[model samples]
Target chain A: MDRIPILKIGAALLVTIQVDLHDSVAMALEEDLSNMIVKAGAKGVLIDISALEIVDSFIGRMLANIAGVARMLDADTVVVGMRPAVAITLVELGLSLPGVKTALNAERGMALIQRRVAESGLEADHAAGEF
Target chain B: MRIRQIVRAAALEAGLSLVDQTKIITAASELARNTLDHGGGGHASIERLQEGGRRGVRIVFEDTGPGIPDVDAALRPGFTTGRGMGLGLSGARQLSNEFSIATEVGRGTRVTIARWK
Candidate 1:
């Protein structure tokens, strides 16, 4: 029943996935992120997966699902810090993560979210401060 | 998660490269989930393989639930009977160096995959 913590920064939500998540834990994360976006009026979501060693089909689908739900809730989701090996395996696993936006690191991910927020005219002044 | 750790250790012990280790571990995860969700719970076996001078790791997932009726269709990408994205079986096959599947409609399913170092 462990839940991944969601931190709110400016108008965005940040999640650092440091564990090789169990299926139920991943599901709970998706649900928790959805609720946090609505409750905090978050315009962007940043998920850091650099620490995770692997992403199977289940985790890949979870990322896509999070992006889909965020889009539906009027928010953008950016996944960052994927290791090279993990990226190669993900693509080989037949998942391109069609709808999820990715960044090489957290700085770029925050920038992508901020740019989108600025373009969308949704609280453009809120800066994504240092993590 | 225990399965993942076990697979990783086995792959490392078998002298698989980092990328190779990652591939086999991911494949084991996908197949294990299929065994649990689609096959109604099962077991996994890990083996260290040595042939001539080459080393490898092999994983086998077995289940007694309703087996896949059409393995060809099941192995095809983007095919699913459940809520999954339909990449588990096909993806697992692609990740491993050797793959084999045996299933009977009313009996059970067994998927064996191996990766060489």
Candidate 2:
């Protein structure tokens, strides 16, 4: 099975989704990301979806799922680089991914994550809850 | 769905705007998945069109299987025979300019959708 790489940067994790994900692959990614956050004591996750050509209802649900789980794990997930085409499709598919924050690109996403973490408080408070 | 990608390309080649390109491609994806999942795998066809002084793209997904018993029920959101959210049929319909479905129980199913440029 192909695995999407999760790169840990400082207190954050960055993932670039460049494949047309099969259902199992997407499920694996969600699991992998959850485990990585606990092990790394990460505060943020930045997922880039610009390379994906389409965002169906299934894929839309997957994004929301990742965000939902990440929040429960005490991490902020920012889905970044959504192309104009994907944005239009997702809306029509009846999914807005309400809980997932988004950014124009990776740089801005990183900034958003950093700002969020800063406002929430420093590392020790959240790190102690790590799994 | 590979057909989704192809249909999107065809819609683009037909000179539809960026938004329409995505919308048509998304519709094709939902229908193609239905053909494969419910119809036990099938094929699809896509074509560029110029009809009635308008340009657009059309895609047809066909499968020979236990066809839909009631299309009306299938078109309702959150209705599914499987463990899915059942947004494919209804969401796809909402995304296209033109959508049509034909199915005969125990024979086959065919869904055709188009979007004008």
Candidate 3:
């Protein structure tokens, strides 16, 4: 079977996980992504879920957990390209990761991350009154 | 066998990339198995929908087994009522775009999910 693949971009890492988002695999994938972010020293992570059809509670929590771990590693996480039905299911199920950012597409997600990085730097410079 | 095949086929037909289709299939298989194992048996249906020019697929799994008494607790991550890892409901909810559940004591449980193409 073709399992999920981790795609690395320049500085920004994209983990293209295409898992059934089911039971055991869901848990395992969450752990795997968490470890990968820490080990890779990636500055940003994008989760492309354009393929998923369902979103259960365990999967929701796991995604949130992965995001938490990535943040601890100083890598931002963005979920991208979810189908509308899948989005509705997640909301109906009451499974959500509040505060975790998401984008309609991967490109936008990457751009958002870049902007965050730039904004943080600009804010620090301004605090020091640096031009 | 039919359920498994249906799940797999539906995942692919739903426009999930090959890798994502597999993930969705896996999730559906596990959930279908649980329906048989825990619910004693159930029926699932799949269909395609187009809303506002966007396409997607929806799957509904319904069972007449003993209704879950504490749905809130049952949905907790890592909590299982069966011997298996309690990831079925939770996992399925994660892999799709929408998930909804309706059930009553001694009646039945109905789960609806959709994944857009």
Q: How many backbone clashes can be found in candidate 1?
A: 0
For A1-131, candidate 2 gives per-residue lDDT tens digits of 99889998767899999988888999999999999999988889999998987788777778888999999999998999999878877877887786899999999998898787778777555544442
The TM-scores that each candidate's chain B achieves against the reference are 0.98, 0.94, 0.87
Model 2: per-residue Cα lDDT over B1-117, one tens digit each: 678768877887899998888888878878888888899988799989998878999888899989999999999987999866688899989988888989999989988888998
Model 1's interface RMSD: 0.8
How high is the lDDT of residue A125 in model 3? 28
TM-score between candidate 3 and the true structure: 0.55
Evaluate all candidate structures by whole-model CA lDDT and list the values in order.
0.91, 0.86, 0.68
Worst 10 residues of 1 chain B by lDDT: B78-87
| Best candidate according to TM-score | 1
DockQ of each: 0.86, 0.71, 0.11
Residue A31, model 1, lDDT: 95
**Which digits, one per residue and each the tens of the lDDT, describe model 3 over residues B71-117?**
88766756787655566777677666787888777877888877776
For candidate 3 chain A, the 10 contiguous residues with the lowest summed lDDT are A122-131
User: lDDT by residue for model 1 over A1-131, one digit each (tens)?
Assistant: 89999999877899999987877898999999999999988888999999989998888889999999999999899999999999999889889997899999988998898788778786534643533
Clashing pairs in 1: none
Per-prediction RMSD in angstroms?
1.9, 3.1, 9.0
- Identify the CAPRI category of the predicted complex in candidate 1: high
